[model samples]
Target: MTAGNVVLGLCSYTHDSAAALLVDNVLVGFAEEERLTGDKHTAAFPERAVNWLLDTAGVDPHSVGLVAYNFDGRRYLDALAATEMYAGRDTTRDRAQPRAESFRKVHDRFGSRMADLRDRFRRARVVPVLHHRAHGLYSFASSSYDAAAVLVVDSLGEVQTTTLGSGRRLAGGGCRTTIVEDIADPASLGYAYGAVTEHLGWRRGDEEGTVMALAALGDPTRFRALLREAIPITDGGFSLDPRWFPLRVLAHDYPRVSAGFIAATCPARDPSAQVEAVHADLAAALQERTEQVMVHLARRVRSVTGLRLLCLGGGVAANCVAVGKIVEAGIFDEVHVPPAAGDSGTAIGAALAASLDNTRHLATGVTGRCYLGPAYPRLVLAENPRPGLTAHRPAAPAKHVAMKLAEGHTVGVFSGNLEAGPRALGNRSILASPLLPDVVERLNDTVKFREPFRPFAPVVLASAMADYFTLPQPAPYMSIASGVTDLTRERIPAIVHVNGTARVQTVTADANPFLTEVLTEFAALTGHPVLINTSLNVKGKPICGTPDMALDCLTESGLDALMLEGWWVSKC
Candidate 1:
């Protein structure tokens, strides 16, 4: 495709802002704004990201064919107007700033693009793809299944709580996916999940992962009565009882319930140091119930469509724990989850959807690397190494860094094309001995500064994965949670989560030989085939971009050493 025909999908201003550039239906670059902005879940226009892509790819903005925004401001504006009418606000004065504010934000973002465009380009071509279509396309276009049942779940999108689609491969190699069912209004699983997340002491979107993790600690059997009362599953789907959970105007920050259930279900924890067994049990039950419901939904999709393969997208797919259960249920023969599985991935989906009609085509397998962002050459760091940091040439060679890692000192491996997704894989990751039991606690306390219960993933030499975990297939994106045997866990306690499962990313020598050789060599030295692989970043920021960034993270975090390209540095 000529540069002009390329469609750049931008999801800006909304949460998890991102940009995905598509050329002739092939995704070339996709990145989230948070990574560039250095803010966790940063919701802003990804100007730096856009500029970086144009610079890296050497493409001009004017050459872009179409810019696809993932949302329709008109729809949001309609919602805002209706909200004001519902609230009986003074339309002239009180609501003026809000609407003006919205216009200003949108104008400030898109207006620049409008001016930058060639004078000949039509304004109508700058399109706004529907919200659900973006979610559907993200799952369908990135999936390997040609004709599979598709489920897109998020808190809310274009009045759609959940959608069911069928994706099929087209004759000539592309694919066509159609929405078979759209559950709008009340029957939204995403909203039901969000309601509970809000009920817990966490922000709905930001804290859903916490709730998912916390659920394992508690049993929700006692709360089943209350849960059913709160979110009832009907023949259609799930619904939030308007009394307990009310849908407020779009302007409201968090979805509001009548403050009644908050007092009833949520009580202050005792000041004394005591863990609430009941609370833990309640959380456990909720998680179980959620898993059951998701299975039920998956089964419904299978029975309704009779398609065994499934592709999942949206925020709920981020719940790897629930996803593991869904996979283990054996309802679907195979499942694929997109790397960015959230709003950030929508740009890829929407642009792809716009390019195809309803025809069956299997998507290429998930992109394993998260090196989609801009990369800095080693020379950039060599020109100016920060004071006291000696820039030695790559130790031994690119291939020999793996041998050094096998020899036992912790080695930070940053090489090759960086990964294109959220996972660090081997290209942009920190590699250390997983044999150390304290590795997990150390990484969390000294580097991650997050909950110790949070587990690190293991990137094993792919040839050795079958012996460690009963993996159904190669999990390139770290999407599947697999069980590590007691024998394996004893050897590598660092990567195992509390649930006794690890989000494993297996590597093949053919895929990443330099890193794989390192793992193979490490195994020869220690008899363990896995390495402790985490993103090369500080606790709050996205993964590092330059050698300097990686070096700073390594030095500040008190990590032992770094192996960049060929140069190896040990902490002085």
Candidate 2:
């Protein structure tokens, strides 16, 4: 069958399930199931997201050339068996027989699901791409560099937990990727990191960022020896000592491994209370060790590939702190981490891999911004105004919002399409003046209801990024953290973390014009072109998706006003 211009991508039955529509190899629509369903890190099938993308793109599902799924269940079974054997689990004929039969049934069920998708789509063929390969493809394809060493490190992807590869743009306009190494299951840095997160009394995958934040408050030297024993950095790869963390029976059972590690290393304590100094030190050590291993990996990749550009994906790539360390090391001239570096981005990678030959016309370089979700009409806000709020359609919404932010009002800005990944990136974001230190406490206590240690990101005008943070280039997506300059630390205390760093998102006029305008106006008012930006949602909820969700966030949270598309609504 000839590959057509349209392809649909789906990622489900794993965390951060999402769907994407690629028309003629150009991504037209994308969204996570969590946003549409109001479920955080949903693993359920993204049927609603798929339907929404199809409707938004005005493409008939039946006409899609291919439906790419970011999983291979067969590989999963192989990895599970390997993990059991590595852990010294009884895998003799007597024990392996029933497991083999059960695996066959599960594999057959996965095959049937793919067949069902094919039947439902009628003319479309369903293709399954290996999870880490999908992540590598997305990282390489979405990057601006023509060739780069790709690294994918996640908790688990099929049988492999980490992949090192290379991607290059073909002279013929397509892209090719080759895997150089694969770190199989049970020796996963991602899982190790998740285990530390669990040990710190945070949800593994969901709260790893919180652990990263808390790391800033502790001294890594305190637990350096313990962490070194847990995860040893090898020559070309890293090893998670099985003694420290046994091979997990289930991928998400990180708490078990975490409990074991904590029991072996630290003093006994209550699990539900605030983090103690030891917990912070452990977090620090884990974070430091992760950065060391990542930098070592990057250096090895560069040495092997001789490529100056590096592209990273997978759950571990979401560690802006580690990314910053990699950049500071100067192992690679440039590094690109896609906005949706996590599993949600595998949808795009699967679509790209399946539609490789069809992507000649797709825009080259970085793919610009990630505002690929649904966009609400301005009329919707006008027609449905919430109570005790006055809606005003100003001549210049950006300027009005900028003035409010200058006055220290926290504003929820919901504009254009929602972002595809975790970071808010102006759209579906809460904005405030970064100069006021109290703003962080306010946002933590009232708006986000998150831990005080969780630092906010700064959305700075791209042109002005160098003035604030010492960065080589613009971080269009909040994918990396950079040290705040001493001036910046003093000027924008709200966004600066205890370690004097900020997860910075630099916006260009071409990518986010409204946000640029708002920053431009804000600069004119406050002599700074930066704002404290956090996702526009309460704690434990997915970022706001629609106008109604934005309204609800505004009313429930401490946001002073909300900018929905072009309509501004202020609480009375």
Mind giving the per-residue lDDT tens digits that candidate 1 earns over 387-439? 55555675345445556555545567677655655667787787777776577
Worst 10 residues of 2 by lDDT: 90-99
TM-score of each: 0.84, 0.93
- Using alpha carbons, what is the TM-score of model 2? 0.93
Best by lDDT: 2
User: What do the candidate models score in CA lDDT, each in turn?
Assistant: 0.66, 0.82
Worst 10 residues of 1 by lDDT: 357-366
CA lDDT of 284 in candidate 1? 64
Off by over 4 Å in 2: 1-3, 80-109, 251-255, 258-260, 267-272, 357-366, 382-384
For all predictions, the C-alpha RMSD in Å is: 5.1, 2.9
